[model samples]
Every structure is written in C-alpha cells, then in structure tokens.
Target: MNKSMNVFVIIALVMLSGCFPSNDLEKKQVHLTGITMGTVAYNIKYIEQPIDGGTPIPSDVVVHQNVERILKQLNQDMSNWIPDSELSKFNSHDSLSPVKISEGLRRVIAESIRLGHLSEGKLDVTIGPLINLWGFGPEARPEKAPTQEEIAQAQARTGIDNLMLEGNMLTKRIPNLYVDLSTIAKGYAVDLVAEYLDSISAHNYLVEIGGELRAKGFKHTGELWSVAIEKPVSTERAVHQIIIPKDNAIATSGDYRKYFEENGQRYSHIIDPDTGKPINHKLVSVTVIHPSSMTADGLSTAMMLMGPEKAYAFAEEHKIAAYLISKSENGFIEQFTVEFMPYLK
Candidate 1:
C-alpha cells in the first residue's frame, strides 16, 4: 500500500478506538474532531462552564477555529510533505550555514536530537534517506527490497551527528542530510493544542492528534479522562486496556498496522536508524506515558526499535511508565513498568 493510504487507514483505526465519546455521555462536554497533519485527526473534549458564573466559555465553533489555526501553522512549520514547509526547505538546503527556524520547530528538533542521544541514537531524524529507500516514506513503495549498495548509500547520508541546532538556528554538518520529524511532530502538535486549550481556560480537556494524547483536569462528571489502548492485532480492533490518564500524555508506537509482508516476511515502517531497516523482533507495540507527549512519542518509537527485552530493561532503568506488548506463540504477552501499573484498568 502507498504510505499515504496506509496512514489514512491507521488514522481510521486510531479513531475507532476511544477517539470520541460513547453516545450515552452527558451533553455538558464539547467534543470536536477534524483532520490535521495529512492523515491524522485531532479530537478535543472539554468541559464547558461559565467563568466566575458571569462570562461564558468560548463557543465550540470559536474553539475549533482556534485549534485549527494553531494546527495549520504547526503543519506549515514542521511538515516535510508540504514541499515549502520550513523543514522541507531546510532539508533541501545543501549549505552548512545555519538556517533560522521557527521557535516551535526549533524546540521540536532540539528535543528530537536530545531523544536520539537518550535512545542511544535509535530515534534519528536524519534517517529520512533510509526510510525513503525502505518504501515507507513520501516516495512510492519499491517492488523489492533495496539492494545492499542502495542501502549503503542511504545509510551514508543518515546520522544524528549530521545535524545540529543552536538557539533558533539549525545547521547541517553534511550536505543533503535529510531530517524527517514525522515520529515526533504529531505529538508536538498534541502538546501545542493542549497548551492552546489551557490558554483559553479549557483546563478540563483531552487533546489527541494522530494516536498521541494528553489529558488534564476532570471531565464534566468529575471523573478523570479515559483513553483506550488498542490491541496489537491487525485483524481486529479490541481494547487491550483502558486508563484514566490524569495530567499526563500518552503515546503508542506499533508495527502491526503499518507494514508490508512479502513471502512470509514482514517489513515495518518503524525503522531502526542504526540498522537502516525495519525492526525485526517479537515486540509489537510500546505505549509510553509522560508529562510531555513529544517525549512519550519519541520514547515509544525508540522502545519499539529496542525490541522487547532491551526495551523493558531500558524502561526500568529510566523509571519510565511504559507498557509493552510482544508477539508469542501463545498469542501476545503484555508487560508494564512498575510506574505504569497504577494507570492500568
């Protein structure tokens, strides 16, 4: 399948699992859903009440418009597919000279670089060339696996050391060093939307972009916001677990929904930067909970690349609240960090 088409399917599957409330919910909460960042959908659920019993909360229409505007601006700055987006322009630049970037993009790129180090270079933004070669990027899927020579060439152009961010300016250590922020951009968008909601006094709300989510405060009924973790099976959509995540962000990365199988071999879109190939392991999905959705997003991808055992150990060492699901002959095996147990339902 085309990468874009697969993304739409993934978004649809994400939407199917707790992206909206059930029909029996109270009417006091405002729910809004819309498309953003190509194939992802943004869902916002917030409680509506008067301020000081005198000023009315912003109308749903106004809130939606504001959210859309914020997301549009974010896309313009970070989307690599936009051709003229800031990231796109930077990628196409062949100079080692510093290029000034928007504060938002700068923050995201800096965080991505920091995560690349934290994950032992597992989550590299400079892996774009390899990703495109593996048929999981903007380029069309190839008819066969890339040749060793092709893979070597792509790998040569990729490295976390090839990029640097100083203040609001980003510079490349090597020419034609491409950087793709797809792994972390949606999560940043989620955080950005959540920040905007807070600015408007939408304290009690849930913000989700793509599959990354953040929730704060309580619902209209005085309960914490609930979210469902989808089972890792591709054949069916089932809730693996539900959690009332209060004042924290959640992100999940999985290979089940985004991969191509050929001759009984599966190639996932989640590439391991060090290998320049999709991760081949029993680990199927990783869900991370943190205060920053961006951090959780990057960590989930890094954990997936680390596979099951190493990822579990890494989570334990870092004291991160992470949930891991792995493929087994008996079906699936689920595990969680000590810190994550309290949120499981």
Candidate 2:
C-alpha cells in the first residue's frame, strides 16, 4: 500500500516523535533526507553534535540501504495482499505446512495476534473484507451501505480466533478470512528501522513513515524530539505539540481522514466490528504515547473504538499518556489523561 494512500488524518500528524534542540551550545547541525520503502516514503533526520572533534556518523546511504533491505523483506513476507508473499500463499493454500519465514515477519505476526487477543478482538487482523467493503482500500464501494445480512456475514468471518499460529507457520481457520496489517504494519516497520539504526551505535535520529515515528537518543543539540498533535478536523494544521525523549512511541487514530459523504451523512474509515459499519462517535482523533510501538499502535486504534470516556479510563488505568480531540457543538474539545499532563509544557 502506498503511504500516500493513507490520508494524513491522525497518526501522520505526529511524525516528529523525536526532535531535540541543543541548549546553550555553540554548534548546531541537522541532517534531513527521505527514503522510499515498500509502498511508503519515509522522511529521516540525523542530527549529531561534534564532541571535541568527534568523527561524523555513518553516511545517509548506509542508513537508507539497511532500511531498504528490512522493508523489502517485510513487504514481501508479511503482506497478505500480495499473491506470492508468504502470508498470501499461506492464506491461499489453506495448508498446515510449516512455511519458513524471516524473524521480522514472525515477530510482526506474533505481536499482531497478541494485540488482537489483548484487545478482546476489538483490533482484528481478519478485517480485510470489512476494510474493502467500506472502500477503505483499493476496492470499489456499493452505492449504499452494506445491508444487515451482508455485514453479519462479513462479521462472522472476522476475528482473531480464526488465525492459528504454530511456530513459524500460520493458517487461517476461516476460508474467507484475510488479514490486513495496515493498523500496525507501518509503526512496526518504523520500529524495525529504528532498531537497525541503534544497532549501528547511532543516536540522535528521528524516523517517520506515513506519520508514525520513533526517536533514537536525542537531537544533535540535545533536546527532546518535538512532535505536533493535529486538531481533529478536516484541516491541514496542527494545534498543539508534544516533546518526547527516546524510548517512547506515539500513534494516533481517528475518523477525520478517509471519510465519505452519503445522503448528507459522513462515514469514516475506522470500522465498527460489532455493527460492521464505520464508527460514529464523538471522537475525532486519539493520540497515544507508549514505551512500545506495537502498544502505541494498537492502543490508539482500540481507544478510538472505545470512545472518549472509556478511553480516558482505560488510559488512566494503564498509566498511558494520551491526548484525545473530540467534536462538540461548540467546536473541538481537547482532553488528555493525567499521565500526559507533565509533557504539556
């Protein structure tokens, strides 16, 4: 899937997850570049402060090359949409044969399944049909919303329980079940890229793919990464910003993007699994910051589905920092969990 295809609605607005600025320093530097991986174009920045004649880090070519290799493998292995990809072949053949897969693919699939279970099936990978039926992807849409009977049939085939994983192999228990990793794939890929950069002993870096981002050590000037939280309306402006240090990930999920209007009603891309319809709630967007990219990605989506009040409670209970933008008759109301208040400055 082309990253461009994903409207910069929620997650993309927080791409600057890490942006540290040097304070009381004489020297300043920044490295800005872009790299294309799979179907997404990532904007990468490498900032470093020379420490008493410290040698410069590796060139941008090296970083791009490494990211390319990882992304290529991920795109090929984890993609169920591709006919010859490992997942596609497995789902197509419906065979229990143990297919060997790369470590990255294995980890991605495992984490996805775990999220599906932990979220009580709220975040499901077997929602490909739902996504397509609602015209969230490349599929055509019907002139009207899916009938109750059609939605029920799609809902029956969608669930985490339909997936069976044993060691390196995976098989679909339901014949029509198709897995779409759009919810977390980009975030996972960003983390993988960050890990590779860390492996090379490189710090002070920020990487963004389709607006999902991960930070390394610090900015070249030694300030936390500064990212903007977008207002949850149909505008291209950001109303607030958050600064985060290393070892944290942020993801946003909302319905402001990729929505269609029919009969004077708006239908968003976020599907309501229970009703097999686009979610219609008070929330416009939810941004989540966590220690893990996978957690950040999944929780953002789950909270979007859980609505405002429950999402606040859930975040508070989990000790997660969250910022939610909701729609009201007066305008947009901004709310945040207590955990995120410390970073409000």
lDDT of each: 0.84, 0.70
In model 2, state the lDDT of residue 340: 77
lDDT of 2 at 169: 71
Q: What is the lDDT of candidate 2?
A: 0.70
Q: Report clash pairs, candidate 2.
A: 12-211, 18-225, 19-224, 19-225, 19-226, 20-223, 21-223, 22-221
Please provide TM-scores, in order, for all candidate models, with all chains considered together: 0.91, 0.85
RMSD of each: 6.1, 5.8
How many clashes (backbone atoms < 3 Å, residues ≥3 apart in a chain or on different chains) does model 2 have? 8
Candidate 1 lDDT by residue in tens digits, 192-248: 989988877777788888889999876665556777778787887677767666689
Residue 291 alpha-carbon offset, candidate 2, angstroms = 2.3
Q: How many residue pairs clash in each candidate?
A: 0, 8
lDDT of 2 by residue, 71-145 (tens): 777778777556787767655665544557667667777888887776677788788778888877546877887
**Which has the greatest TM-score?**
1
Candidate 2 — which residues are off by over 4 angstroms? 1-39, 48-56, 96-100
